[model samples]
Each structure stands twice: as structure tokens, then as C-alpha cells.
Target: MPRHFRALAVQPKWHAHDFTSAAAFKAWMRSQLEMARPHLTTNQPNLVVLTELNGLPLVLRGGRWATPLGTFQRVAAALFVGRLARTLPLMWREGVSPIRALQLADADANTRLYLHTCRDLAREYGVYLCCGSAPTPRYSLVGGQPRRAPGTLTNQTVILDPQGQLIGVADKVYLTPDEEAGGVDLTPGDLSELRVFPTPVGDLGVAISLDAFRPEVIGRLEEQGCTVLLQPDANGAPWTAKEGLPPDPANLRDQPVAWLESSWTASTRGRSIRYAVNPMVVGNLLDLTFDGQSAITGRAEDAPEPRSYALTSPRPGFLALTPWVTTGTPEHLRRAGRERAAGSGHPLENEYRTDVIWADLTLPATALTPPARTAHEEALSAILGGQASRNPSRVAPGLLAGLGILAYLSWRGLRKR
Candidate 1:
């Protein structure tokens, strides 16, 4: 009989209060895992995946003054004021701006909290956990303590075994423009360094966010005999808004339709990679907002055509998809966007909710067998041929606005000093 396993995709809402302290963050994470407990099976392996940059909010831990600030600007301002002595010198020494400097100053603490929380959760749940990504400089555990080293910052994902020990780490290779020089200023991981992690369920390949949209990245993983793909994402735009210009010439305005070209389109394209899980983070971080439906996709053996499956309908490829609570329609989503701009909107307008979408999937009889490139690949070639118009550059407006706010605040602080 073929081996079977359960895959859980977590769609978590980001809240500033959750990061009030290490204890609070861990408790929130535990609660999210608890939501998945009912779906797990004792007879098979379980793989739990969270969204990209899920741990990035931990930077606000210990910022009790900023907990009630809610909006990104106010909280950032509070953090900047509270940690001026540390951020100022680090900013000057590292030749970085105040925004990046604040992140760096708390990098070590963020890593410890993020890692320990996920590690403990994996052990408690007895599952293989992909703890999502965190933006931090490279570091190592020295005497069981996280020690930082001088290096470029990268969005890195960690995988922990059921025993609560880390088994894999994959840094994001392809970065969005916002993650480049002008935005968060993160360094991209080398594509050559991508690794396939072995687990009881199957061989796992992790493609963080935009990385999943690249054929080269997917091909490299398939070449290494990967059976399952984990694409943890945090979409920075309205899920119902038009996907921008040019490539979307037909005026294809739906975000979910445009998103299909990545994970759903990849796994069903006649590769050995049989299943994919995409967990998206929803909610806003200051002027920056992320919204998307989390989904699980798979290729069934008896399907008439090579099509991907999702949990929710209206789309064919997804086996399971988490629904948007408040921004389900275009009008409502646009209204929410407007409210965010005016700085007056109900928090639920961003679809801030925690959901878990999971499915029992069959694993390949042998984990090392290479997948054959079939006609399915040829038929679906167009999907991955050209890049979608919805690239990271679209976030420039929000980033610019946030930067302006930071600049004004910094100038005022300097003048007061």
C-alpha cells in the first residue's frame, strides 16, 4: 500500500498585540497549532506549513509601548523612540537607514523567540513543521544560544523535526523589488544552494513566495527528486484588486486567477511533485498590507485531465482554499484599501482571521524516483513561460509612503536631541 500523510496549511492573521512579548507570541502560535490538532491522524505522518515572514513581527516583542499603537507607522515610531540609543549607533555603523537598523538591532532576539516557539510547537504536535520565514542576518547556535554574525540579511525558512530539532533551512533566492535595495534591503539566497529536505512523509522542497513563480527554482527542486512543494507566501496587495498592467492586458483583475500560475500550475504540470501547499498571511503591517486565500493543490491519479485541486471552488486547481472573511468582494476590498489609506478602517476589513486548510495526500512509493517530463509539461508550459504583471514593484507606493513617514519622524527626533 502507498504511504499516506496529512498536510496542514496555516493562514494566520498578523496582529501587533501578539508580539507584545515572547510569551504572548508563543501562546498565539500554540493556539494556531491547536486549530490543526483535530485534523491530524495518528497512523500517518503530518507536515504543517505556515506563511512567509510569519515570524517577522517578533521584532516588536518587548515593545510594550507600541503594542496598542496598532498601525505600522505609530508602532515603528514608538520602537524607534524606545530603542534610539541602540538603533542610532547601529544605523550609523551599518550604513543603513533607521528602518533597516531597527530590524537589525532586534535580529538576535527575534530569532531566538521565533525558533524556540516553533521548535516547541513541532515537538508538542509531533509533526514536521515548516516554521515559515524570518528576515534576519545569518546566525548559528553557540552553546545552544543563537549567535549573530556580520552578513547580509536574508528571508530564511526553518524546518523542525517531530522531536523539535531543526532539520532544514532554506533562504529565499528570488526576491521582490521591495525586498531589494530600496525596500527592506535584504540579500537574495544563491539558487545553487537550494536543498531538498528528507522527511517521513516525503522529500520536501521549499519555495518562499516569489521564488515559487520561477520555473528555474521549481525545475531545480524537481531535478533533486522533490515530491512535495511548500510555497509560503505573504501577498502585499488586495486579493480582489486588478493585478496591475501590461501582461494582464485582458484586464484579468482577479488576484486568485493570477496566483494560479505559481504552485497550482507547477505541481499539475506532469512533474513528480504530486502536491503543493500555499499558506498566505493576511492583514496589514502599517501601510503595508498582505491578503490572500491559503490553498492546497494536488494531482489526482483518476482525474480526466491533468488538473490541480483546491479546497474551495470557483477555481479548478486548488484542493482546499481558505475564504476571505471581510474582503470577499472587489467593492469591499477596495473600500478597505481606501480606509487603510485614510487610516480609518475596521480591523476585520483586512480579513484578519486564522484558518487551517489540510488534506490527506498519498506519497510516492519510492521517494528517490525522478519524475518524467510528460505532455502535461508541454500543455502547461505557457503558464510559467512569462512572468505575471503583479511583481514586487507594485509595492513601491506603500513603501515610499512609509519611508517618508520614517524620514519625517527621524528628522524630528534629531532636532529634539
Candidate 2:
């Protein structure tokens, strides 16, 4: 029998104030789903997809002073001061930089607030939920509870069944420059560990943010017979901004056009993957700004040639695309800032301008059979059963204690200055 389902790509505009507490974050997430409720059908399976780094804001949880800050640097500084006791020790114990340590300090809280909330929401809506990626250490389920496993932090995405049980996780295989050593310092996941999770809707494969740009990542999943590709994204640059000239400089294109070539165009042009959902996280996190038009792309039998959209020129295979309030140029951004400072708010700054783009998709009949578990899946299953051993640390305890003391003294001296 042919299976049909509704897939929703949720474009969320995040604000610093939303991460003030776990309750606030969950409430905000619930409201996003509420907006999609009317479009969902009771007769068919539903898949709810969120954007990448949507859960990254939860690192500000419990840090009241940092939640209101306007820039990433300021927020990080305030968070370090407010959670000094916890972050300091983690930095020394993990032998990682301050930013990485802070992420580690809040890893458990992030996991609980993010996954548990998604779990509850999935159960409430009876939808398969893909809780987007977060910058956190690997965690394994022990005794039916999530426990932090010893590992470097990476961008990880989790999928849940309609009953809210965890189906699997896919960590990002490619790391952008910012995610490398000098920035957030996240570790890259091995591409060999990718898994295709089978659901009533389709065989879903997640290729997070930059990972989607890589042909190998998409090819591996296609080889596994994945019918639906979820590309959750949070572009660090403006959507309208023109990137540097490519190898063929004559074909100048904006970020959206380039992204489309790698995503929608790639998936639809003679590919077996039936559908691709790309959800984007927009809005500002101080100096860091994320902006992109969330979209759903697929191949339709009777569909006409693709037409031009707001940001991109004539492009095919787009099923649905969200609209943005502004063009996001430097001048437009400056004007928006001036308007906010003068007590008149710009529509671009409205965090409540959330959108959910949905498309009804038909799946191939062969997509129902679940594939055999790969080796990575077997290891994940063992970890869920609490049979996996914790990784041992090589650093001496006394050396770590000394480093902690030194870091504390440096922090105190900087404050004194």
C-alpha cells in the first residue's frame, strides 16, 4: 500500500529571552507546534521538524544575567561568571576551552529540557518529531534515563517515535570553520556512523546543516534507501547576502541560490530521495545572526517547472518556502537597529514571527520495511541498555586541580582589573 504523510518545516525566530528558564523554552516550543496543529491531519502520519541549533539557546538556562545580553561574547562572559563554580571545574576536568567547558556544564540540562519536551510534544500530537541539533556531548540512555557519556561535544540531532520513544540520533559529520577548534570547538562525527531510521512516514535520514552540502553524506543515506531527507539548518550569514565568487565566477549567486543547488536541486534532480525538508532558525543571538527561508522540496509527477522566489531566482523542486520580513542587507539591518532604538520596532525584529511550512507527501511502497541494524545502531542499542563502558580520562587528577586553581586566579585578576 502507498503511504502518505504530512511533513512540517518549522522556521523559528529565536530570542535570548526565551531561554530564561526551562519552562519558557518548552512553552515557546509548544506554541510553535500549536501553529502547525491546524494543518495536520488525524488520518495520516505527521513529521514535525525543527531547525538546527534550536536547542543551542538552552545553554543559557539558569543564567539569568546572560539571558538578556545582546551579543554572544557578552552572554558567554556573563554565563561564565554566573556559573563559574560549575564551568570552571568542567574546563579543567575536560581539558577543553572555556566555551566548550560551559557547553559540557550544561549538557545534561540541555538534553533533558530539549529531548523531554520534544518527547512530550510528539506524544501529545501523535507525530514523529525530529528535535533539531544541539551542541552537546554524547549521551546514552541508562535505566531509561539519559546520562552523559564521556566524549567531545558535537552537533547532535535526535528523532522520536509517535509514542515519544527515541528512535535514533545523527551527529553532524562536517564541521564549519566556526565549529572548529578556535570557535565553539565541537568535534566532528564520523560519517560511517550515520543511520537511517525507519518510520511509518518514510525511511528518514538526517544530514545536519553543513553536512547536507556534502555529496558523500547524502549519497551514503541514499544508498541505505532513505526516502525522506531532513536538512535542519541555521545559516550563520544573511540569506540575501552574496557569497564570494565561485570557481566559475560568472555565475554569481546569493546564499539562497547556492544553498538550493546543494539541497533542493540536488535531492530532486534524478535522485531516489522523494522529499527533503529544510527548516531554518532565524533571528539574532547578539553578534551572531541566523537567517534563512525554511523550505520543503520534492519531486511531483504533474508539477510544472519551478519559478523564482523572493530571495532566489528561478529554481525547481521547492514545495513550500517561508517568507522573511526584510532583505537582510547591511543597510536594512542598520535601519532596523535605528528603528528599534527610536522605540519603533521593525518587523524583522519580531521574534513571534514564527512559520510552519507543511507539505503532503506520498512515499514509495518499499519504504515500509525497516533495514537491518548497522554496527553503529547496535552500539547505540547497547549503550541504551547501560552495557557500554564509560571512556576513561588520561589526565591526572592533581594536574587538573592545579589548572582549575590557575583559571580561577586568572578570572579573579581579570575582574579586579
Candidate 3:
């Protein structure tokens, strides 16, 4: 069998429920991370890239907290702040305190702390945890400021090793006007350099979601000698399982192989860049997209054309590869962090656009080439405890089985009442 590493690309969705309160957001994050962990361990890919806005809180306001939330909260109800306020008293009276309400008062404190812990957990599990689709730049004209493209403080991507230790951070440098169209004052980050780090497997490049849409980010990664690109993003209408996608719970139509191919070729044809098409993988809780149809693509230096594959079974496992050279930082991130820490928002003054194009990367099973299974597989297999003996149809067969049972009981009580 060919040596194949699996990448668990994750797109963690934070809906209104996720941000209603700090606790909710944190709990949601923990749950998502836990769910994604199994896949990460089983499919120890070269790298695990998350393509969602996990690092930052989408704040909003209302409830007893009476706090203003993150900009993402604005994306929730189309209604304005005034409208959300009207319903606040009702929620407070009825003892309804959403997670977003708590986030507004203490945004970074808990968020950063949670992220720090999450990174550690990821490292402990031996899965590379990468966060993307965080806050980026925005087109804003707040506080009588000039209508320039300013660095809007949004979400950020966090990187962790198998032990979930903090490896690096990637701040998004692009933002779409529509994302910030209903502005409560937003800005954009600089068009910074791509950030790469050395992993036990190979050099990995991580860029913001929108940044990947541009040839520059991918080219820069290749220039930096990256063998894999891990992109974690939350995008578009919920995905469907057609056209090559794994089964989408949302039941939306999909364009699988084409989706997978677009990500694989992101940086393959850029100027001053001469790396063969590095297999780009995208991950989310429910989906895994690979560029080459099969997991086993030829060596990085010699991949076959029109790459495709076929698989007889659904083989999702934890994977890992050898590590390579890791070094360097994005000048903008350092400068911005320093500037923000020093209370000088000078870096926030710039005009730029972050347009991210997501390509679906679901290939047909037959087109999939299985990667080599190593001790890494055995390690994850041990962790999973090989519960295949049970019926796979039972969704919450693990620890969550208890929660499912509890929910069932609660429902029975409510119906009786």
C-alpha cells in the first residue's frame, strides 16, 4: 500500500447559539474540537488545517449582560442593535442568557485562554491543530476616521503540535466588504507574507482563508518550501454530499471532485514558484476534501496528471508524516501584535481586500488513492479502542451516548408535562 497521510480539514460553524454567551461559545468550541480529534488522530495527515473563525469571538450585545458583542454577532439577525435590544428584556426575564451576551464583556480574555488550552490538548493528542478564518481586515469608516482600508480586529488562526502546544499564529490580512458591509466599525490587516512552520511531518504553510484565494499566499508557501497547505474555513451554504462530497447532513447539493481539485491547485501555477501541486486539504467536522482523487498521490516531486482515485471503503484515520525545516514569521503579525499591545493602533490604518474562494474537494471513492498506514495509524487505533465491533449506525456510541440518553429522557418528561 502507498504511504498516505490523512488531513482532517475542519470548518467549525459558530451560529447564533455558539456566540450567545462566552460559556456557550467555549462549550461549542470544546465540543467541536473533541469531535474533530478522533478524525485527526486516525488520519494523521501531513497537517490538520481548520478553516473556520475559531480563534476569535463574533461578539454581539443584549440580555442581562447588556454588553456589546463582536462584529460577527452583527451577522446573526439582520436586525440592528436597537432591534436586538428590544428582545433583551424578554430573554433576561425568561432567564435566557445567550453565549454571545457573555462574550461582549470579556472577549479576548476567555477566548485567548480557551484557545491556549485547546492548543495544549491538540498537542497532547499528537494531532497538528491549525485555526484559520479568524478576524481579518475590513472596510470601515468609524469614529469620523478616513474611509481607508483599516486593519479590523477579527479572528486569527492558532497552530498546535501533536501535544497541542502553541506553534504559531496566522492573522487574516484580507476581508470582504460584504463581511463588514453592516459595519460597526471594522478594518483590514496588511497583505502580509505567508507563515510556515516545521512539523514532524514536513514544512506546513498556513494562511487566512481569503488569502489562499490569491496566488500570492500559496506561492509564498512554496517559496518558503512548504510541502502541505492546511486551510480551515467556514464557508458558503451548508455543503451537500453530491458531486463527490461525503454525506452532508444539511442535504445540500455538492460539487465534490471539482471542489477538491481547486484547493489542490491553489498555488501550483503561480509565478516565481516551481513546486509540483502540493496536495491541499480542507477539513471540517463533517467533511474531508483531498485534491488528488485518491489519498495516495505520487511523491510530491512526481504526481500523475489528472490525478484521481477510487476507494472501496470509507477509511478515515489519524495520520502523520516526517517533520521538516520550520522557521520565520510574518512581519505584519509581529508588528501588529506589538503595536496593539503597546496601545498604538497605527497598523490598523490600511486599505486592502480579503476575498476567499472556497473550492469543494470531495473526490469519488474509486478515485481516492489510500495513503500508507504507519504506527501512527496503530497509535490512533489504540486510542479509538477499535469499537468497530458495534453497529456504526448508532450515532452517539461513544461517551456522548449518555447525553443522547439524557436528552431522550428530558424530551419524554417535556411531552408528559
Best-fitting candidate, measured by lDDT?
Answer: 2
lDDT of 2: 0.71
Candidate 3 ranges with C-alpha deviation above 4 Å: 1-6, 11-14, 40-46, 55-105, 136-154, 181-186, 238-262, 267-417
Deviation in angstroms for 397 in model 1?
34
lDDT of 3 by residue, 1-417 (tens): 223444544333333445544456557656655655555535434354544555343443122132233233323322222333322332344332222222222333333444544554565556666644444222223443312122224445556666654555555555533333332222344445345655553455555544555555666766666555655544322122233222232543333333333333443443322222122222211111111111222222333333322211112211221111111233433342233221233554211111111111221122222223323222222322222222211111133444434433433332343
- Residue-level lDDT of model 2, residues 1-417, one tens digit each, is 788899998888777778767778989789878978988988899999988988877777766565456667567655655566667777667676767766787676566567667877888988998888888666555665555665478888888788877787889988876677666668899898887877877789999987887789888988888788999898776555666433344676666667876558546763668888899887766666677778888774423456433455555677887765555655664454334321234553434236899988887666445656544334344443332223311112233445555655644444343
As for TM-score, the candidate ahead, 1 or 2, is 2
Task: Order the candidates by lDDT, highest first.
Answer: 2, 1, 3
lDDT of 1 by residue, 219-253 (tens): 99888877889999988776655664233346755
Question: Which candidate achieves the best TM-score against the true structure?
Answer: 2
Better candidate by TM-score, 1 or 3: 1
Q: TM-score for all predictions?
A: 0.78, 0.82, 0.47
**Clashes per model (N, Cα, C within 3 A):** 9, 2, 91
TM-score of 1: 0.78
lDDT of each: 0.70, 0.71, 0.37
